[model samples]
Target chain A: MDSKLTTTHPMVTADSQSVSSQEEIVLSVQHVKKKIGKKWIIKDVTFEVKAGEIFGFLGPNGAGKTTTIRMLVNLIRPTEGTINICGYDVTKQPEKALAYVGSIVENPEMYPYLTGWENLEHFARMQPGVDEKRIQEVTEIVRLDERIHDKVSKYSLGMRQRLGIAQALLGRPKLLILDEPTNGLDPKGIRDMRIFIRELASQGMAVFVSSHLLSEIQLLCDRVAIVGRGSVIAVGGVTELVEDTQHLVIWELEPQAQGEQILQSIPSIQVLDLESSNLDNDTAASLRPHSIITATPEEYISTTIATLVQAGIQIHNVRKLSPTLEQLFLGVTEGEFIE
Target chain B: MNSIWPLVQNETIKIIKKKRFYVVLLVLLVLVPMFTYAQMRQAQENRTKFGEDWRVELQQAITDNQNSLGSDRVPEEWKKYRRVFVQQMQYYLENDVNPNEPGGVTFTREFLDNSSSLFIPLLIMTIASDLVSAERTGGTIKMLLTRPIRRWKVLLSKLITLTMFVSLIVVSTFIISYVISGAAFGYSGFNIPVFTGFQPGDTGTDMSSVHAIAQWQFILMQMGLIWFVGLTVGLLAFMVSVLVRSTAASIVIMMAALIAGTILTNMAASWSTAKYLFMVNLGLTNYLSGSPAPIEGMTLPFSLGVLAVWALASVIVSFAVFTKRDVLN
Candidate 1:
């Protein structure tokens, strides 16, 4: 607990700075606050997403992540602040602003009664510069060309997701806002979406994605803003923010009583309490009872396992566990502060 | 994107794909045949009774109505309607032209006149109520409003599509009634001289302005007035669709209002203020056929003004609310 606090607290209080300031800023949300009814849902949020980057909007559910994304795409009006996209104000000049933006707020809801191709045509008509060729190109980009002629109701969930991305790319927007893009995807589908998002970013399009899962953002995003209780708690490079909480070693042993006692004698390592951990029960269930999770520096993991084994403990496995964004950014997602 | 035509095209395709207009066509297909069968049966009965003398038939109708006007049991409003019928039949008798000419064109004209108040406007509501609410229910509104076009432009395109379908519905009603009724009643009355331009008032109708025109011209004018009523009702339903979130609810609200209008039109004549309701003023065809208006102080100009005001208010409400309301989940 002492090491976790010392590692993540200073970064949480640090000013949110863009990691890659050299690229063109495609989206700038400045002090955005949204008030629904009498209570303020989003107290204050500010972030800039540059061109050629996957900027992850990281937050827990009800942390106002979706509400903030809505304000960005002009789906919901922000009571107090400005959202500009590619040099255009989203609220004042949504026509010019949204011209450079393509978004799927939740699920991509195309006209189910219309064929996939007809759905493309329906949206293509609303976007300037999107013609038959452009629609065909986007359909190919999402790899939905084979089923483009079928009714969307016949589409599988992954295919519907691909079609959603296909329509978003129809306008050739500079910035794409996807709210929980991988919320309902299979594992392979999620992998393909990450690759697809990276390919778009490499082509100089800015991708702003929001997700409640920190691990998803940790693997996918170049930079992230961690939101908690309707405000941004921290924004920095994903690597820089995750740098402090180094090695997470999973100590598996027989004779767990002797092994745990021997590991507690080491000064450099600290064991994480499974019951006290903020991770939901599913994550906890995956780790067996004989396995003990510990956070320690890289140099001590081998020695800690050696000491456990020398104490006549049978070493079944010495596996290294990577710290989740949940544990790495404890100042933001800590159990006491999250809700 | 600069032009609203693409949006209109999109809406047109949705309406077609959803088969909403097909529903309207099917309703007409089933109803018009039954109407023709009923008319054919009525015509057969009349022929057997009158022995081919429309003059004798007209004189007998006038005597019956005149006798009813003198009866104490006859309501004052019923007596007023009889008085107008008696006057109109007397005019036809003096002119030596049968008002009940049995032909395709005559049947279409008569059908349009009767359908204008309730039938045609109800058909208009089917498409108009589905205009905006379907998007909300189906969750496509999020995509629709996020486009580069202003919100009002999106709504305007829908309004244009609704208008096109409303006009299509009215024109199809005319054609279907004509074609089907023509197959049942022979199609040779287009050149018959028909009298129009009757100025109906509180006490009686003024026939000084009445003049003879071809049966086709009278049908054309009646269609023009009915189209106006259909368009007005379409605008109101469009407003309901904007205000209500579900298409079924929007349709129900409009159906209730239209049914209420029908009931109100049958009500006592003393409810003079009810004329302002757009539903009650939907009978614009009555002025053309020289029938009495439902209430006192109601005339062609008065009904037109009332309908115009209602349509204007609905348009204002639809645009104002649709452009401003939050598209909440």
Candidate 2:
């Protein structure tokens, strides 16, 4: 599209130089690959998260999520390709690239013996404009105000995670990369994290969140990249990917005596099974045959129901069920369907 | 530059906060006096056993033994030993000094000089060997590196901290020993002169056997030499720490090197190259004290050069590997 030709903002501008117009592409990772001892840990991964977007990375265990994050932060050198954060190349200009990003790749490790406030102050001193007020603001934002002065060794797991998030926010980074930020949280904590990330996104901070929980990503992310075996298998808007799966139609028909003849008459209908049969002298003799017919959502609503009724079958109910995102995700990712 | 000041301040605070450091100071405080008292007692016992008029006895023996016989009376080996001893006693007696007098600051000075060979060196080694390794063990190394400064700057800060403590240890030894021993002995030896040229094989009876140097100057020179060796050991340990992640391995490797240096000096004397070992170079004072050097033919210049080489090599390796190595999981 011509819109793609619009001038894009560079990740990092020269010192004391201002741009007239700045686009909001916060992070760009292009064909990054990594190998450890002849085994590819990450392969041909390309994605970008615009400013204020919450991008989700979903994968199973040992699916190279950690390896990919490590490479993104310039903690480990990627064997091939480039990553640009805030307009600086991660490989050639790591310090400048890292200046715009804050990350927690695995466990949030801090000096356990130091107080939370002390740790925050120490890390803040590493960045520009990060003074006592900044520390206080970040601590309050992460909900660590009550326990900010206590030693980290005394903090619980939830408290530690909050502190880690607090540390990540100290520099007011343009891009925040969190790996499984809700791994050890309870339901309430998970909800709080979801809300916190959303607020961060609203504030124009691009958040790259990695998690294995499909529901969590579905709730939190604007878009997701489904990774499998060190490669990205799918990347798009959540609803778009889920809506692409084929639709299914089901009909509930009655009459125990004539069910078989009705099914045999409609050559277009593939009978799944007879769900139930009951004979009642007072009301009616009934049979429900659960039938699955392959058709488009519109075609199924019009043609399948009309065909069943025209066959002299009592079509009590007919419905078109759109496949859920979970089913579509499983089907595309696993290539299997549940009957 | 701003980071350097903070880093140095933090290092100093850490050294001050550790109670173990205070314990080290306390041990030195106790041990210095204990050894000083023992040396004082030995001097007192010498006075009592040899009689209060031992100076007169010593002067009369030299005159009587030489008068009873001709000029060539004593054997060569015995004559040489006695000649050096008799000349030392005469120098003391001529200065109206009882070398056996145990109650003076001069006595403390003498005592500290005697103990420098073993006591001060052992204390120096204990602190110096663990300077860098301890941080690695404590997991503070990572915290330090993650700061917005270069890794070499961190090490340089540690080196500066070590030098300050080294100076503190050496100077404190002088002050504490001088004050405590002065209480019993009195502080008169501050200006006394010490002979510096009495090599083991310079001659059978060289005339320059007792060339005098200021007692204070001699002690300072000794301290400077020992500190140089101690710093070499610390730097080498730092290199080993950078190579081997574990603290214990670095310490053991350095300790083994020190012990091996000492052993090679004794057992491998025939191999002249053994003189190049760090242990042989550690005894820089041996050349000044005119004692039989553990390794023969070791000169002050040669020992200093060897130590310089070792220190230079360790520093090179440390800076090269630490800066470039990837900090991976």
Candidate 3:
């Protein structure tokens, strides 16, 4: 927990220093618009991932996440915009721009006839001076050694995904772009990928991960840009966006026979819910004082608890519950929803 | 350059390892012998049907025809056989020549010239038609394009590999046809004379004198001309492969063009410019064979220039289209 405190401090100083140094803008897309026939896939969308950040491109299905990632990797040209990566404009100098980026789009279109190692070797050879040692490192990093020599046609969906990641990691790319890297992964595999991504970020490799998995974004991404229907709706640190509203105060407590009556009697404070489902009577007796209240910070939440005790409700526990990312995501995106 | 080499290697591997490529080679293997055997059989039948010694038969026919003609002699149709017969008798009397000179390189070369309407052209088409279009079907096109290399370089490498294989196939055909036919007809005549430089107006009689060009030199010249046609068709098929998304479509399109060209050359004698089409000029050894030009006055240079134009056009169109076209879904 304390590690989070230290990472934030260093990131702040490094961001400021990088801003002055002009080294932070590893990728910049300014007003990128892509229209396929009559429909726009990515409209005036823009963001940048610095040299060493796990920047999550968070969105729902059909939210232009894949389109944005594709444009960044120069797989598709935008109808109107300039995308610059590693000091080269992607359109003007695509080969050079692409040289700095390693990407995995929709599904990894690997050669099915080739073995997993052969697939990596082929892509590895695509990037010059990328030695066999690097190949081994990437294969090990993605934990594909046991099956690296097996033909890709024999690979399961999850194994193929890992192999795709191994290929992306082969060149030690300055910018690694992954589209839903965990889309088909099991729980353990997702955990491993999250750790691996964090390790890459720790090693100063910036990653652009586009996914609808908001919890993973919150857990893994240092920063995220949220998009919907070809436009970015929100962008910032997860905590900053989620904790912007301080009114929600969640607390837990012990059972009191008159717990509901006591909290309801308090003015301008509403006690939201109580559950006896996961509790014994003794446990319920200890947690029957549970409540959630919405109020200004200046309006003490303790006042509701004090009132409850005075009204003959036994109180054993009370503490604020941190807002889950799901609630925060709902709040941020739902605000954009039309009635 | 390093980035593209891997792509090139993979492309080369894909082409060389494909069963279709080897299948084409195997078909050529079975076919060359079949055609050579069939040609030898037909020549044997002609020998038996006419006479054991074709020269004696030719002299007898010419003497009888002359006696029959008595007053009005040497009609146009008789002129051809008479001239050939007279030459055969003169050759027999002067050098003790025999018309049946035991089939050899000379016989096979002649056999190839007649059989080329279908054999060599089909062999060339089999390899070239599906080179790129097959990649599209295998879903390897997407894998190839997404590599960090430029699109043109990818297509360029494929073209290079195709060119190399085309050369290999052409050279292989010449050697195999020679070796197989040579075994039955022993390779003693390394320096046999063949005719060349037969321009249309050089001889008014249309039956020009056979000046001596060596058998190997003649084969080399014919190979050069066939290679030109093969390269043109290969490049054209490449263009078709680029334009058409399916292997079957590409092969059918090229095959139709080839067949149509042969048919038109046979049937369209009145259409002088038909000689200028790429297909008509594919029979490069026509001058040696002394067949009338498919078009009345079309010369070698004119037909070559036309084929060159089509070849160049296909090259330009393929590169331009392939480099820019959006990939398959």
lDDT of each: 0.85, 0.67, 0.69
Q: Worst ten-residue run, lDDT, model 1 chain B?
A: B196-205
Can you give the lDDT of residue B57 in candidate 1? 87
- What i-RMS does every model get? 1.0, 3.9, 2.7
Error of 2 at B124 (Å): 6.6
Q: Which segments of model 3 are wrong by more than 4 Å?
A: A1-23, A146-150, A184-188, A239-339, B2-8, B43-47, B50-104, B107-131, B134-143, B146-148, B187-189, B197-210, B271-277
How would you class the docking of model 3?
incorrect
What lDDT is reached at residue A276 by model 2?
A: 17
All DockQ scores:
0.71, 0.14, 0.23
User: Which of 1 and 3 is ahead in DockQ?
Assistant: 1
By TM-score, how accurate is candidate 3? 0.74
TM-score of chain B of each: 0.97, 0.80, 0.82
- Chain B, candidate 3: TM? 0.82
Off by over 4 Å in 2: A1-23, A35-43, A145-147, A183-190, A212-216, A225-339, B1-3, B18-20, B33-37, B40-44, B51-148, B172-188, B202-210
Which candidate order results from sorting by DockQ in descending order? 1, 3, 2
Under CAPRI classification, how is model 2 graded?
incorrect
lDDT of 1 at A294: 73
lDDT of 2 by residue, A9-32 (tens): 233322212322134667787778
